[model samples]
Target: DKMKNKLNKQPYNTVLRREYNNLRNRITTLTRAARDDYYSEEFEINKNKPYKLWKLLNEAACRSNKKQNKEFPIEKWIDEKGKKMCTKDIANKLNNFFVNVGSELANKTQSRNPRAPTTRQRDSMFLCPITEKEVMEICKTLKINTASGIDNISASTIKNN
Candidate 1:
């Protein structure tokens, strides 16, 4: 009976030990994977900054009428072999080019006019006479304009007479 009891306890101990080891291994793998993912994401974000700057430079160059080779230093980064490099390499080169070109362009270019109209300009254009007359009639009926009263005469009404 003692021998049987010892044999039973041995199997239980072995199984419990294996379960603990398996759990530890899984946790280690998961933590490493998480750390790797975080680092990779950080690297990608860092890489994209130069890429975005390069794209902005390219867009600005495209908008201008000047030839790329003559107007921008980015053309110099292109290898003589004519094969395009990766975005990261191109971006790094272009960022440097922009630093050189941007200052010159800023000094030479005039500031753009504000797109939207000023408050005075917006208020200058009034409603059309035909629509204005309809509005005036409604106001007269409501007795909202007590000062000069409302003009009931409309262009079409006078024309028909």
Candidate 2:
């Protein structure tokens, strides 16, 4: 408070500013150390209770109260033929399936099922086209200073223009 008051009284004083910054740095360091110590103590006390351990960890991490997904990523998996597969192998399998799925679907569609109905069924169709004006209005309402995604069009440009 004294350093802060001194700095406030002489805003342009470099010595006061330096002292204030040093005082603030010391306070921040001490506070952080104390917090770490408290968290460490809590973790030690709750080591036996997994729920409380996770709760302490979440608190230390500043996580929300929402129940988080507890699913752990598969590091290694057992495949058919009793073979142990690495993450890369599992990833390749998934990738290959996804890559071929479209072609497989197309092939199946080309060779239509014999049990299919021959009638060309008709149904009511509705189409609504969003105008450029509406699109621009929405773009204008976007939050500014955000990252430009894959297309590299800036949020500032979208919001302003």
Candidate 3:
């Protein structure tokens, strides 16, 4: 009779305890499910990994704090292929390729401005000396030409003479 009376009085407390337990269980289940999903997604993403060969090449070229060898692992790749290639070789190839392409670009640029000369060439061709006597001499030497605004003669041209 006492047990039945206690149970009747505390029926609300019992229901509250049961609800708390159910919520806790649901939370644990959800947490586990989320963790599992995360790991599975990570696995799938990493399963067929995209090869970052260039990045690897760069990394291999870089020196590590632990090692003495400065050579990159790309050297091994070259070796494996039975092709004896060094960093200098690769660099030379790239330089030659760029030079060839650059010449083509320069040709196009030249077509656009045929009169444009390099700074050294332009200075050599157009620059005049700073002396009035030299200019007078040059003007006098060229009997056919009359000095209108010609003030100077290039020192180099005088030296050549």
Candidate 4:
């Protein structure tokens, strides 16, 4: 209210400006701290209850619990050709992107040196047998609850298994 009052009675006073800034910053800090404390407390209280925890999370995120009924999987997207793309077209586009993404990424990650890997370095290429422990460690490192990659396998699946 003080900030709004200050804005309404606009004056170019250095002291008033400084006081306003201080008050604004203090409000911001206090509100942020309070919000953080509230969320932390809520999370701690619901730590043992998955359903309650998720419900709280959805509420915090302003997510609706209601399911949306739609004929198509996704809304029609306008393509560069000024045509509306259907679900099949979208799937094709995504497939093409994922198929080429690996090579594109590999090309970008290649060493900048011009005189490197002109031929297959079969002599230097050696395969080390990875143990089950190593595999499990790698699997554990995979991020949980993430979107599936081109392989269509969820990281959570591999990590859990």
For residues 1-161, write the lDDT of model 4, one tens digit per residue.
86668755977776778888888899999998998898889999989999989998997798979887756546657789887888788989989999999999998896777685466767686788999999999999999978998999999989888
| lDDT, candidate 3, at 74 | 54
Top TM-score prediction, candidate number: 2
- Runs in model 1 lying further than 4 Å from the true structure: 1-12, 48-161
Model 1 per-residue lDDT tens digits across residues 1-161 = 44445546776687665766677688889998997686566556666688655555555455653556555344346555886566678888778898889788889998687578556665576765578778666545543323332686554444333
Residues 62-115 of candidate 2 have per-residue lDDT tens digits of: 997988878655644689877788888888988999999999998778655667
TM-score of 2: 0.39
lDDT of every model, 2 decimals: 0.63, 0.86, 0.63, 0.86
Q: How big is the positional error of residue 78 in model 3, measured in Å on the Cα after superposition?
A: 63
Candidates 1 and 3, the one with greater lDDT: 1
Candidate 4 weakest ten by summed lDDT: 68-77
* Residue 94 lDDT, candidate 3, scale 0-100: 68
Clashes (backbone N, CA, C under 3 Å), per candidate, total 0, 0, 0, 0
User: Candidate 4: which stretches are off by over 4 Å?
Assistant: 64-161
- TM-score of predicted model 1? 0.23
Sorted on lDDT, best first, the list reads 2, 4, 1, 3
- How high is the lDDT of residue 101 in model 4? 100
Candidate 2 lDDT for residue 38: 95
True-structure lDDT of candidate 3: 0.63
